[model samples]
Target: MSREPMRRTIRGGRPYFFADPAIDKILNMVVVLGSEVWTLRERLAAFEAIQVRQGGLAAGEIDAFDFSPEQEAKLAAERKEFIDSLFRILQEQVEEARGRTARAPQKPAEPVAARKRAVPVRGKSSKTAKRRSRR
Candidate 1:
């Protein structure tokens, strides 16, 4: 029998654990990535142990390993997908904010007369005073 991984389906938005929801989401993503990294590390260690038991690998063999063009392209795609997933929450928030702004009714622009401007005073030594003196 094959087993399928159980997934948690979040309805609406996820509950905020911190004051800022973004912080909470970022922390969640970090923990998830950390768990995934730990799992991969454990698997690699186990695989290396088995390889040693069979036939010992050369020092720095894993580090020196190079991927083919095809493999590199595949890894690149996967990396892009991983990055998109990591920042998806922030992207969604930005999109939502944009949508709200688009739907909002904008205030009408004030007329030229209604807008605030500096009124030239006929004070001594002022531009108005100079014009008057010239006249």
Candidate 2:
């Protein structure tokens, strides 16, 4: 099978399956990351099996291994970076929302004659419209 190049970042909105788009995005990220983790786990298992076959490794050896302080520090940094990447989408969403709100209040003020008050519809409520818009 052919493989596609990995993307460092993805921008803009993604297609959503649920009424709550954030749920969809979170689910998608989980599935994608899960598959990647599974793949790495499989490869690691295979490598360990081969090492055992060659008499170079033993069961529990990896779990018992100790890391140096420098190595531990490096691993901690890498782990932090990996977690940040996993939730980068959420951060982007927050930033985008902030940008929208920040720009909203900056719109040019309209003259009094051009301003119109919203009228309530007989059967429809503004709250319902807002709820639908959030979906």
Candidate with the greatest lDDT versus the true structure: 2
Give candidate 2's error at residue 84 in angstroms: 1.7
lDDT of 2 by residue, 1-135 (tens): 799988878588556788889998788899999999999999999998889889889976888999999999999999999999989978865764465456667776655555333223412544445557999
User: Model 1, poorest ten-residue lDDT window?
Assistant: 116-125
What lDDT is obtained when candidate 2 is compared to the true structure? 0.76
Clashes of each: 0, 0
Each prediction's Cα lDDT score?
0.73, 0.76
Query: For model 1, how does the per-residue alpha-carbon lDDT over 95-133 read when each residue is reduced to its tens digit?
Result: 644654566549565456653342233243244454578
The TM-score measured for candidate 1 stands at 0.45
At residue 29, candidate 2 shows an lDDT of 91
TM-score of every candidate relative to the true structure:
0.45, 0.46
